[model samples]
Target: MNTRMNSTASEAAHQFIVIEGPIGVGKTSLARRLCASLSAQGVLEEGAQNPFLERFYRNQRAAALPTQLYFLLQRAQQLAALQQQDLFAPLRVADYLLEKDRLFAQVTLDQAEYRLYEQVCAKLDIHPPKPDLVVYLQAPVDVLLERIAKRGVDYEQRIERAYLERLNEAYARFFHEFEAAPLLIVNAASIDPINNHADYEELLAAIRRMKRGRLYYNPLRSRGI
Candidate 1:
């Protein structure tokens, strides 16, 4: 049975949703799962398409400018295309928030490079559609490292602990002050929602019921999983 079908109103509450988190925290995986469950269109980031990404990962100082610029332009173009679609279109689930690009710029680039990046961003003038709900996933640095290693991406394996720590802190700081949409802060350290049906269902239900304000979801392993 499709448990989601049981709550028609809840399903309709959120038409456009975004899943955001630090690298290796599984936002993309969760976004795909949510799209499958909700039968929504997905506007996901194509991180692999950036040619300079692996180089940036290997040596941040050398390739940070080009890497960040490429991502910024790619993300802006994606959002622009999405905006051109029908206004009354069906549900859409995205794995990233466009503003998060600036977060990366802040973390990876030095003063002059960031200034140039900001100038380009200002000129591009992208205004993404506001999501109905934003799901922010959180986990410890060790948990992030474990998940990254488990995935076994070649370039991702080279990610340093210090880099992840800085990125993780940037995410925390960004979400702490974020208030543009209804926010859901999820402690994703323990539950394996991608593989566990019960965990996914509970989280999905919570996502459906969300309509306004900020909510925190911290599920325990002792919840009979």
Candidate 2:
């Protein structure tokens, strides 16, 4: 825990942090761990509990708009609360970024629908606090599918392999050009941040080393185990 990276991350005065990745890449789990370590507030995305989610899984074309709308409204409400209150502690970790909302819209909606969605989003005036650090987790689609299956969410059981593949690609494309904050791109395919203290330590170190711009982390090649 006293590693250079860990020490640096601890010393830094970061008010906002975001852990982002495709589904089942463990963003929420990492955010939880980070919040615990930092003694910070954690804002997690409420996934699948939305009534429209199961229907979207069963019939994407029929349920896409409603599912998207539900998520948008829920996220907006959360952000509104943050705006009106002392939502952040000395440090704060959120599992989702408001901008990432667009990624789903682009992926799940048709051209016309997406255009309409964008129009609505443009009017929301929701300015999320910029993260001091944005950790982008990456893994193969196969790994994502495996993790999702292991999690045993009944509605997610029917998640098509093709959709997962597309989502993976979309995430990759989004993060490739992402520059909203200091970025740490982590290869999570072989790294288990939970139940793997070494992996978690390495990640903490990597975050500290991130000073500006973007950095890449392949846990397969970390030092001094």
lDDT of each: 0.91, 0.84
Off by over 4 Å in 1: 1-7, 223-225
* lDDT (10s digit) by residue, model 1, range 1-225: 443465577776787899999999999999999888878889998988999999998999999999999999999999999989855577899999998999999999999999999899999999998999999999999999999999998999999999999999999999989999999999999777899999899999889888999999997657553
RMSD of each: 3.4, 4.3
TM-score of 1: 0.94
Leading candidate by TM-score = 1
Q: For residues 8-126, what per-residue lDDT tens digits would candidate 2 score against the true structure?
A: 44446467889999988999999999999878778888986689999999999889987997898889888887767762234679999897788998889998888888888888878
- Report lDDT (Cα) of residue 134, candidate 1: 99
How do all models score by TM-score?
Answer: 0.94, 0.90
The segments of candidate 2 whose C-alpha lies over 4 angstroms from its true place after superposition are 1-10, 87-89, 221-225
Candidate 1: which pairs clash? none
User: Pairing residues by index, what is the TM-score of model 2?
Assistant: 0.90
